[model samples]
Target chain A: MRFLSKALVITWKDALSEMRTKEVLSSVVVFALLVIVIFNFAFGASQEKMLLVAPGILWVTFTFAGMLSINRAFIPEKEQGCLEGLMVCPISREAIYIGKMLGSLLFMLIVEAIALPIFTFLFNLPVLSLQLVVVTVLATLGFVAVGTLFSALAVNTKAREMVLPILFLPIVVPLIISAVKASELALSRESWATLASWLGIMGAFDVIFLVVSFLVFAFVIEE
Target chain B: MGKSYLRNILSAVSFLLMAASLYMVFVYVPTEATMGIVQRIFYLMVPVAWLSLLSFLIVFIGSILYLRKKQSRWDVLARSSAEIGIIFTTLTLITGSLWARPVWGVWWTWEPRLTATLVLWFIYLAYFLARSLAAEEHRGATFAAVVGILGFVDVPIIGLATTLWRGIHPGALIFQGGLAPSMLLTLMVSLAAFTALYSLLLLQRISMKNDEIEIKRLLGLTAERHNTGDR
Candidate 1:
């Protein structure tokens, strides 16, 4: 219960800050929208003929948008030099990590939520099914699990902007593959049986990453 | 045996084993009937790929040990192993491509195993880049260690997903055949030789890292002395 509250407090603090500033969320949402628009231009006429590639494009947008948010996940703490202050808090470092990760996850999911409707309307793909939503959540969960950790790790590096994506994209390949496949099945309106394996893969990846990331969060948060 | 003597023996044995493996690869292993001599590349590629995973396992173990012990040596071991592992992985991809070009008739295809190997390569490449670019001291090492452990954990999952994706996507090439005993024997020997070589490379790299650290320490000491003397 203490751990839960500590993590929630951190999450609540981030939520309040974002509500006020709206810095990271606005930029990520815009970037994600831009990616969709660009993809439409590049593959507009062809997409109608072959909607199969739509899932790939959707995921590409989400991954890039998620990257943008993660890049700034630590900017507020970094600029204010408040991570050190957070470290000094009575709560465990794992709590701090959970807070930051949840904050990033929520921020990314909001962008994803906004992008989803636009994506479906623009691409005219059937992506609003329950299975797709679950896949999206699982995929994004695994994504931010590592993304939050890497962002904190990258924020301390020299070339942070470059380092974060390099560190992030490779580790999230499982999520990308599973998410894209599951989305493809859902978009095509395939039966649940066909999407089952992909869902299983995403679930396994998310659980493993979340647990592992939580365990090692202290190492990154500490000096 | 003394430490230097043991290292020397290890190095010599590693070289001899590699030579024997090469000879067997060229002379003993008959040309595969279907793919002809180009299939010979599989001997080298398979073992190198196996050892690459072994090297990654080393990095994973070393990273965990460093986190537990907070020792510089463990960090050195992990860093060196990651560097060498990436090299072997690169070789694996290239050789796999070489074989694929003739056998599968394409230089590259999104085959699941190859795709997984490619992703593994990217993860480790990112590992080295992150380490070098990170802040000095435990800041970088600790973060890289965390990434290392997480990345290792990610590999099998990614491999499975991609393998399953291939099933959904459907590709033209599918082969399930038994290997001859002679080929299997050669593969085992090649794997052993590659393991020996990996050990030698890791030891040498770690020693070099130690020397580099000593040099850095001495330089810092001199700079400190100069500052004190001027005061």
Candidate 2:
């Protein structure tokens, strides 16, 4: 019960900060939009080519924008030393990881939510379906689970800004590949059985990292 | 310190084993009926690729040990293993390219095996960069260890991805079908030799690291004694 309250409090704290600042969300959305426009110009062609490349473009934009928001998610806590205070609080370290992960996920989801319609309009694809939305959330959850842990790790390093992606992308490549493939399958209205294995792979990745990060968060958060 | 003698023997054995493996690869092993002489590269490529993945496991294991124990020796072992892994991975890529050039008509293709190998190379290179670019301390070691552990999680995925997603790479040796008895025996021998060589390299690196620490400790002691004498 206490842990739940602590998590809620931390989540609210993060959401309120973002609401006031609007720094992370705006940057991610704008960057994603810019990427979509650039991709459109670069790959200008008929509808078939657009359909083929659209998934790749959407994932790339989401990944880059996700990195931006994740990096910023911890900066304020780090700069003001609030992270130290939070660490001293009588909450589980896993709660802290979850709270931060949720904040980043919310920020990323907002960017995706906004970016999707824009992407649909710009690329002339139909709005994504319920199944696609669920897949995106699952995929994004996997990305954030790994990203959250890594961002916490990287935020302590000397080259915090540059280190996150270098540390992250390689580890998360499997997730991105599987997710993008699954997303493409979903978008194309392919049989779910064809993508069942990829979805399983993604789910397995998310569960493994989630547990691993939860176990290690205490060690990482210890100064 | 007495382990130096054992290490020397191990080094000699490693050299002899590598020479024997080379001889087997070139002389004893018959060339493939289809791919001709260039196919012989697989003799080197397979073992090196196997060792490369083995090194990742070593790194992962070493990292877990380091994280649990906070021992500097494990960090050194992990770092050295990762470095050696990179070397073997480079050889794998080069040899794979050599084989591809002859068979696949192009020097390179986005084939799953080739792409995965390239990604693995970049990942380890990033691991080294992450380690070296940080200050030489526990923080750096821990950070690198974490990345090492996480990075290794991709190895099996890459292996599986190549198999799952249809591409030009051959299916995994174990699962696709049974190999001929002679081929399997030869592969096992080569794998054993490579594993022995990898251990030899790791032991030598660990001993060298120990010597370095001892030398640093001796220097510190001498500096402290000299200051006291002067006072």
Candidate 3:
């Protein structure tokens, strides 16, 4: 119970920091919007084609923006030596991982929420469905879970900025592939069964990676 | 070490087996009616692919061993195996592309096998990058080991992706029933040769790594002594 409160407090602290500065969210939003605009201009944004491609475009933007956001996740902690202080705290390392992951997830979700409505308006697609939201949230969960771990790993490297993507893209291929596929299927009004398999894959990947990352985070963060 | 001598013998056997396999591929095995001479390249390409995957598995196992034991020797072994695996993987891609040129009429396609190999290459490249960028000596080994294990998790996925998707690569051998007697024999000989070759390369690379570490250690000790003497 005490651990839960500490986790929540850490999460809140991260959120509060982001809100006060708005640095991560602003950069992510601008980057995502730019990606959408580039895709619109490059692909001509036809309604028919947009419907087919929007899910992928949305996710790609989210992924790139998420990468940018996560690269900064540990920076503030490292810069201020707060991670060391946190490491010396009584809180469990697992709790710290959870807290950081949740913070990242929340930030990413906020960006997605903002992007989705703009995407719908620009592309003239319906974006208010609960199903779409659920898919987005689940996929984002998988992304953030893996991203947080990689973010921590990359932070310690000399080339943290370059190292994150190199470390991330290959490991997360399964998640990205299944997420994009499932999102596309869902958007197409396909039967639930069609999307179920991919969703199951995404869930399994999330669970496996989450557990593995939790177990390994202790070693990774060790001095 | 006894293992080094064993590897030496394995190297000799690999050379002999490869020579025999080449003979069998060109002389004994009849050309396929449809693909003609180009089909024979499969004999080389398939075995190399098999060896590459096997080497990657060895790398993963070596990494786990390194992590568990935290021995520098295991780290050396893992790094050596990965380097050899990359070489074999590169050969597999090249031979595959050459075979595809005449058959598929294109140098490359996003075929499952091809894509998988590309991904595998990137994963290992990342592994090398992770190792190279690590500042601490032991940290490099630990980071490489972790990446090594995690990267291999994609191998089966790639295998499955090839099958599930409309891939131009031939269906996997295991699922397509047994090979013909002549083909099976040729493949067996090739596999044996390549496996031996892999062991040889692994041993050579590991020895090199050990020597490099020893040099570094000696240098560090010398520097320490000079500092103490100056003091």
TM-score of chain B of each: 0.91, 0.88, 0.89
Descending-DockQ candidate ranking: 1, 2, 3
- The weakest ten consecutive residues by lDDT in model 2 chain B span B167-176
Summed backbone clashes in each candidate are: 0, 0, 0
- Runs of candidate 3 with Cα error greater than 4 angstroms are A1-3, B1-4, B161-178, B222-231
Residue ranges of candidate 1 with Cα displaced over 4 Å: A46-50, B168-176, B218-231
lDDT of 2 by residue, A133-203 (tens): 86788889988988888888777777877988887788777777876777788778887787888887778
- Worst lDDT 10-window in candidate 2 chain A: A213-222
> With candidate 1 superimposed using the best TM-score fit, by how many Å does residue B37's alpha carbon deviate from the native?
0.6
Model 2's i-RMS, to one decimal, reads 2.0
Misplaced by over 4 Å in model 2 are B167-178
Task: Please provide, for model 2 over B1-231, each residue's C-alpha lDDT reduced to its tens digit, 9 standing for 90 to 100.
Answer: 678887888778778877877777777777767778886676677888988888888888988899899988888889888888999999989988888998999888776777788888878877776676554467777777877887787677765665465533435533345555666666767777888888888888777887898999999999999989875
Location of the lowest summed lDDT over 10 successive residues in candidate 3 chain A: A196-205
The native-contact fractions of the candidates, in order shown, are: 0.94, 0.31, 0.33
DockQ for candidate 3 = 0.51
Query: By lDDT, who's the top model here?
Result: 1
Candidate 1 docking band: high
Looking at candidate 3, what is the lDDT of residue A217? 72
Candidate achieving higher TM-score, 1 or 3: 1
Worst 10 residues of 3 chain B by lDDT: B161-170
Interface RMSD of 1: 0.9
